[model samples]
Target: MAAQSKIPQATAKRLPLYYRFLNNLQVQGKSRVSSKELSEAVKVDSATIRRDFSYFGALGKKGYGYNVEYLLGFFRKTLDQDETTYVALIGVGNLGTAFLHYNFTKNNNTRIEMAFDADPNKVGQEIGGVPVYHIDDLEERINHVQAAILTVPGAEAQTITERLMESGITGILNFTPARITVPEEVRVHHIDLAVELQSLIYFMKHYPLEIE
Candidate 1:
């Protein structure tokens, strides 16, 4: 694996997509796959897939394409698939509860080991086999967690984010629409569902398909 700093952020983000497709190919008893095949499967352009793979230097041959087993092995090591990443979920609202139940079941490497909620009724209860604790124990319970999923109300996003940072949470997957601020050391990825839906509608309106 190349130094992560050398890979473009966009390309780095697509690695998981490639790894997933390769896993599917392997499961289907496919030994090799071309960039075009991978592109079609992952919905990424072939040229873009080639460039992304180029960052890792000769991941596939010109004619032979990529071996499913080899590519999967490479990505498994690169993505640290064997290692488990413990994540904490904040706020056990509807969205948070859904996350706890689903819990990235396909991705074996990541798991929401525990969750936090402000509602007293939900506290000390277990959902989807994950124990829920009070928000007051955020710092104490999150000591071993590397990342967190923030699904609290927009008003509480910033305050809870600060508490998460104070507890040494370096990465946050924020589902709230608050756009909370964080220091350089902390990384936050926002998943604004409304914004995404709006963008999808915009694309549908402006780039409507042409029926043949």
Candidate 2:
């Protein structure tokens, strides 16, 4: 595998999609797949898929396409699929509770091991098998956590983000609308659901497809 730093960020993000499709192919008893087939399955263009695979230096043969089991094995190692990633969730509100309940069940590598909330009523209780601790115990409880999911109110987002940084949380999946600031060492991925919906509507209005 090539150094991940050499891969384009967009391409890096699509690797999991490719891996998942390959997994499906393997389960379906399909041994090989072409870039065109992969493109249709993952909704990515064939040329782009080929370019992404080329970053790893000849993952597929020109005439034979790609072997499903081999591609899955390669990506399993690349994505560290065998290792587990523990994540903490902050703010057990509606959105936070939903996260705890779903908890990335499809992905075996990632899980929300614990959750934190300010509400005393919810504290010390378990939701969807994940224990919820008080926000005050965040730093102590998050010592072993590598990442966090921020679902707190927009007003509390920055303050809680600072606390998460202080607790040595390197990655954050921010669900709050607030654009919290972070140091260069820390990574944050914001999922503004409302904004995403609005963007979807905008695209639907302006980029309508013509079906013949």
Candidate 3:
């Protein structure tokens, strides 16, 4: 596996997509795959896929294509699928609860092991088999975990992020609109639903289509 810091963020983001398609190919008993095949399955251009693979050095021959099993093993190690990544949820609201219930089961590498909330009714309870601890225990519980998915309100985003930093959290998947800064070593991935919705609407508005 290449140093994560050395790999470009764009390439890092596409690794999961490549892994998913490769897994499917492996299940189908595919011995090898071409860049074009991966491109089609992942909706990335063949040239782009090839470029991403180049970052890790030549993975396949020009005519032979990529060996499914070889690529699978390489990526499994690259993405750390062989090891489990425990995650904590900072909010146990509706969206947070939904996340806990589903919990990315499709990706066995990751799991939400615990959740935190201020609601008395929700505290000291377990949702989707993950214990819900009080917010005051955020630092303590999160210290036991490596990463977290932040669903707290925007106003509290920075505060919680600071606390998480203090507690030794290394990665954060922030769902809030707020952009909380951290040390360069700490990775924070933001998923703003409102912005995504707006982007979708903007695209559809300009490219309207009629139902057949």
Instruction: Kindly list the per-residue Cα lDDT of model 3 for residues 119-198, writing each as its tens digit.
Output: 89999998889999999988666767889899888998999899888889999999999999999999998999999999
- Candidate 1 Cα outliers beyond 4 Å, as residue runs: 210-212
Stretches of candidate 3 off by over 4 Å are: 1-6, 207-212
Q: Write the per-residue lDDT of candidate 2 for residues 1-212, one digit (tens) a residue.
A: 35567888898899889988888888789999999899998999999999998886646787789877777776787787878888999999999999999948474488899999999999999999999999999988988898999999999999999999998899999999999999999999999999999999999999998899
Q: Give the per-residue lDDT of model 1 (tens digit) for 1-212.
A: 44457889898899888888888888889999999888888999999998888876646787889878877776787888878889999999999999999948585589999999999999999999999999999888888899999999999999999999899999999999999999999989999999999999999999998999
Candidate 2, superposed: residue stretches over 4 Å from native = 103-105
True-vs-predicted CA distance for residue 136, candidate 3, Å: 1.3
Worst 10 residues of 1 by lDDT: 1-10
Q: What value does the lDDT take at residue 102 in candidate 3?
A: 92
Better of 2 and 3 by lDDT: 2
Model 3 residue 210 distance off true place after TM-score fit, in angstroms: 14
Model 2 vs. true fold: TM: 0.93
Model 3: colliding residue pairs: none
CA shift of 127, model 1, Å = 0.9
Per-prediction TM-score, please? 0.94, 0.93, 0.88
RMSD of 1: 1.7
| Model 1 TM | 0.94
